[model samples]
Every structure is written in C-alpha cells, then in structure tokens.
Target: MSGLTVRHPHPSDHAALQGALTDWWGGMGGEAGAQQRRLLVPRLFLQHFAGTSLLVEEPEPAGTRGGAALRAFLIGFLSQTDPDTAYIHFVGVHPEAQRGGLGSALYQRFFDLVREHGRSRVRSITSPVNRNSIAYHTRMGFRIEAGDRTEDGVEVHTDYDGPGLDRVSFVREL
Candidate 1:
C-alpha cells in the first residue's frame, strides 16, 4: 500500500472515474443500477469543469505508473441556500479498495477544503434503500435532515433514464 493523494480531477480522468463508479454500482446490482449511478458522474465532471465541484484521487503507488486509479471521490458544491454551506452530491470508494480508509480520507479532504473556503455545513443525499450509504454517512457524523424523502410519486427528472429512485438528504455541521 502506498500513500493516497487527494486532489481535483483533471478532465482526462473522467473515463477512469466513470469506470470505477460503474463497477461499484454494478457490484451493488446490475445494468439498471449502474446506469443510475452513471448519470451522476457526468454531472460531477460538469461541476468540476465549472469550478463548483471537487474530485479527489489516490494515485497508484510510486514506481508504478499509468493512469492512477481513482480510489474514492465526493462531488458537490458550495450551497446557494447558504453561502457557508457545502453540499455533497455523491461519495464512493471502489469495492476492492474498501477497509483501507479511502472513503474517510476522501471525506476529510473534502471537509478540509470546505472549511478552507469558510463553509460551516456539509450536506448530502442517498437513497433510503441504500443502507450501506446511510450507515457510512451516519458514521461520518451526518444527521438525517427532516423533510428528506425520495421523490417517489414525482415524475422522474427529465434527464433521468433509470427506474425512478428516491433519495434522502443528510447533513453535518462543520
């Protein structure tokens, strides 16, 4: 194991990031599930491209070089509702890389970035059915925000292509 480095993602890193996320989702289920996660990556890239998102990477150990695989990532932006708020859109670690603290490391990096920017809160959402995600968020100190729910009966967002999934919001004060 080598040291993990976290930083903003370059545009060229998109493909590998997408592949990792696709694998994570597929392991959780199949194409339908993977497709749902697939929608988030491009959005994350777009946010990063727009200067509103952060993408953290863990380069492969030194002396071994190619494209460094993205071990974990968090995507979101500083909030408009509260200029001091940082919202997390998504976070994940490659299944094979779990138990190495990649997820926590990614969060710490993001939290530090947010604090550096003077933000006071970090918010995020995950599907209620994703118990694992809920547990992880809770462990990281996020609290369930009231009024959070899946948009169950609402029409899918025009941009959405998968089975409609509901999500619940979580928040942590930094």
Candidate 2:
C-alpha cells in the first residue's frame, strides 16, 4: 500500500464505491451479482462514520486520465453495543486488486485509526455459506462463530437475512 493513501470516505465517494461493488461482484455470476448489488447501503456509514470507515486509492495507471482507481473500501464504526467494539459493516476489494493483501492493508489502516478509542474488539458478520469471507476473516485473525443469537432485541433467527441464510459472526480483539 506504499504510495497509496487510506483515509475517511468522502461523502461524494459513495456513488463510485457503489459502482465498484456492483462491478466487482457482478463479475461472479447472475445470482451473486444481484445479491451483491442488494448489499450496498453506503449512506449510513458515509454520513456518520467518515472517520471510522476507509477508502484507499492508487493512480489509475501510467496513462489513465482519472486520478486513481478506487481499489478497496471498508464501511464500519464503533459499535453501539455496551462494550463499544468496532463493527465492520462491509468491505470490497476490486477484482483486479484481489489476492494482493489489499484487504488486510485496509483493516490495518482502520485499526491504526481507532486504536486509541478504547475499544478491544472489532467485529463483523457474514453469511454462513460465504466460506471465502469466513476464511479471509479467519486469516485476518477473527474468530468465527456459528449459531443463531439475539441482537439488539431482534431475533437473529436462522437465516437472519433470508431463507437458508444463517450468519457467521466474527470477532477480533484489537
């Protein structure tokens, strides 16, 4: 990530990030594409958590006209739960940039940003079947938890998102 900068997401950057998400996941398959597009709700994070979320960009290429390619992003915040853990909401690594350790870099940058906030944990959740995410999170040091649990007074019933869509919660000590 040298020569690239990681910083708070600018409000106007939402549309572009949304586009990147659509493009990145749309490359997987029709079903995956539709599901991925449905996953973006960027305003909530950009509006209130610009400092806790992150975006990293690099020069497009030697001859490109644009400023740089938006390679990756993470939407997260300090949890409202009693312990005030940091909760990561969403993350995306552009298809072209996947497998290059960009995801880990994004997390490390966020950790550096919030390390002084007195939070001891960073948490996230993913669909139980998204083994890739589970593996990635595990590699990044998050403990994977399987099972249904209530959260914020809502029954995190099985398939909390929909039929056959149980979630796998993950927590990493900060």
Candidate 3:
C-alpha cells in the first residue's frame, strides 16, 4: 500500500480488472460469480467516466514494462436525475487489501470528489446475501433505506437487480 497511487482508470485496464475480479470477490469460482463478473465493470465506465472513477494501483519498478497490481477501485458519478446526489456504481478491493482501510479510503475519496462537484448525498447498493457488504456500508456511514420488502430481517429492494435478485440500498448524507 505504501507505493500505491490512485488515478483515473484507462480503457486498457478493463482486461486486468476483469481478470482479477473473481479473486477480489474471494474466489467466486462458480457460475454465480461468473455471471456477476460479466456485468461488473465494463469498458464503458473507463471510457466514459474515467474522470469520475478512481483506480488504486501499485506501480511496477521503474524498469518494468508493466505488471502493476490493482489494489482497489471505485466507479462513481454525480446523478443526472438528482442534481445533489451521487451514486457509487461499483467498487472492488483486492482480497489481501480488505480490512486495511483501502475500501474506506476509496469511498472517502469519492465523497470528497463528489462534494467538490456539488453533490450532497451518495448512494449505493449491495446484494441482501452479502452480510459483509451490508455491515461495511453501515460502518462507512451509509444508512439502509427502508424498502417495501425484507429479507432475512434486513430490508431490501426486491428484484432491484432483476427477478429474485434482492438488493440492500444505502444512502449517506454528506
């Protein structure tokens, strides 16, 4: 983490990010993980929202041709429908980097960046089954928005992603 730097993602990063996504998600090696990874971070985000996204990478030695390790990343953007709101579309932290504050740092940086752009609130969502995500978001000061349905005692937006894909929506007021 010492030499890691945050910068805007490039189109070329899509492959590396995709290659390591499953591992970052704790080796999601089954069909479910495969399906999720396919839709996770597309090249369009890097191409269109590079300015709004952040990529944390550990640069290779001066002489190396490539091989920078992707430590973490956050894809966020100011809301077009809601002038004062911003949305964190996606985020991923290398498994080894979890609990080391990398995720929080990414979120904090996004918050600061959005605030500078006149955003007063930030929103995000996670699957109901991801208890760690639910806990992490709350610990990061995001409050779960009450939904019309509840799953496993936690309120969730039913079919937020699609049929049977419930999501826990969160929002934080800055």
Best by TM-score: 3
Off by over 4 Å in 2: 29-32, 35-39, 148-157, 162-164
- Per-residue lDDT of 1-174 in model 1, one digit per residue for the tens? 356666666666667767877787646767777776777778446545435454555666678875566777777677767888988877777777887877787788778878988998998877666778877888999986665233443211222223565556778998
Off by over 4 Å in 3: 61-66
Q: Each candidate's lDDT (Cα)?
A: 0.69, 0.77, 0.87
After TM-score superposition, the amount by which residue 93's alpha carbon in candidate 1 deviates from its true location, in angstroms, is 0.8
Error of 3 at 91 (Å): 0.9
Clashes of 2: 1
Where does the lowest 10-residue lDDT sum fall in candidate 2? 148-157
TM-score of 1: 0.78
Q: How many residue pairs clash in each candidate?
A: 0, 1, 0
Off by over 4 Å in 1: 43-65, 148-164
Candidate 2 yields a Cα-based lDDT of 0.77
> Can you write out model 2's per-residue Cα lDDT over 1-174, one digit (the tens) per residue?
887877788788878887876677746546676456546555767889988998989876777786877889998888776455888888988888899999998888777766778777888887654668878998999876545675433223486667766677888887
Best by lDDT: 3
Output the better candidate (2/3) by lDDT: 3
